[model samples]
Target: MKACIYPGSFDPITKGHMDIIGRARNLFPKVFVGVLNNPAKRNLFSVDKRIEMIRRAAAGMDGVEVVAFDGLLVELMKKLDCRIIIRGLRTGTDLELEQQLSVINGKLLPGAETVALLSKPETYFISSSAVRELIEFRADISDYVPKEVADMINGGNAK
Candidate 1:
C-alpha cells in the first residue's frame, strides 16, 4: 500500500492542516500525521497533547493515523515504510525551505519523495504559529481552527 508521512509539530491542529490532510488522504493509501517532538522549540502543548489534537481533528478519517517522533523525519519515513512526505506550502519562503529539504531527503533516501500541497486559498494565511499568536492576543480564532479546537482554545482547555 502507498503511504505518506505528514510531519509537523502540530502544537494545535488548524483547519488549514485539516484541509491538507484531507487532500493527502486522496493521494496515498495511508497518511500518517507525524508530530515531531522538537526539544529546541518550547511548545505550548506537550507532545502527547499535540498528538491528541491531531487524532481528534483527524478522527473518523479513513487511512489517517497519528504518531509522535523525535528524530530525523527521513528516518521515520523509512521506519514507517512511507514513500512520500506531505508538506504544506504557504509562501515562497516555505517553498524554498521545503524544496531544499526535499533535495536533502532525496539524497539521504532514494525511495522517499516530498509532495508539496498548497494551502487552500481561504486558509493560505493560517498557521499554528499564527493561531498561537492570535490566541495570545485574545483574538477570536473560531474561523481559523476546528470547532472543537476553537472551543479548546477559547475555553482555555488547550493543552
Candidate 2:
C-alpha cells in the first residue's frame, strides 16, 4: 500500500496540477491530492469547490483521491500514514522554496521524503494565480486550467 501525498492550495485545479497528479499516480499506487484549506488566504473558490473541481478533473485517474485538509502537511501525512510528498517544480524559485519546505518537513517527520517533479513544458507557465487573473479580466483560460475548472470559472461559480 505504497502511497504519497500531493498537497497544495489548488484554488482551482489547473492543467498543471492535473499533469502532476497524473504523473504522481503513475509512480505511487495511491496519490492523495491534499487541498489545503488555509483560512488566511483569500481564495476565489471555496475549499469544497476546489475539491469538487479536482475530483472531476481527476475522475479517471485511479488511486487519486481528493481531500480537504488544514494544519501542517506533515500532520496530514501522519493522518494518512503516507511518507512521500509530491511537489511540482516549474522554476528555480519553486526549487528554492520547495527545498526549504522539504528540509523542514523531513525534520518534522523523520523518514518522510519529498519528491520533486518537473512540470511539462506545456504547463510550465500556467499557475493558479495566473488563471485567477485571467478569470478576473474575463480572458479565455481554457488552456491554463482543466476543462472542469475552466467551466466552473466561466460559469461564474467562483466565490
Residues 1-159 of candidate 1 have per-residue lDDT tens digits of: 999999998878899999999999999889999999999998888888778777777787999999899988988888898879999999999999999999999999897789999987999999899888888899998888888777766777766
Error of 1 at 123 (Å): 0.7
User: For every model shown, what is its TM-score relative to the native structure?
Assistant: 0.95, 0.97
TM-score leader? 2
Give me the displacement of residue 21 in model 1, in angstroms. Answer: 0.2
All candidates' lDDT scores? 0.88, 0.91
List where candidate 2 sits over 4 angstroms from the true fold: none
Worst 10 residues of 1 by lDDT: 150-159
lDDT of 2 by residue, 59-91 (tens): 888899988898999999999999999999999
What are the clashing pairs of model 1? none
Q: List the residue pairs that clash in candidate 2.
A: none
> Candidate 2 at 21: error in angstroms?
0.4
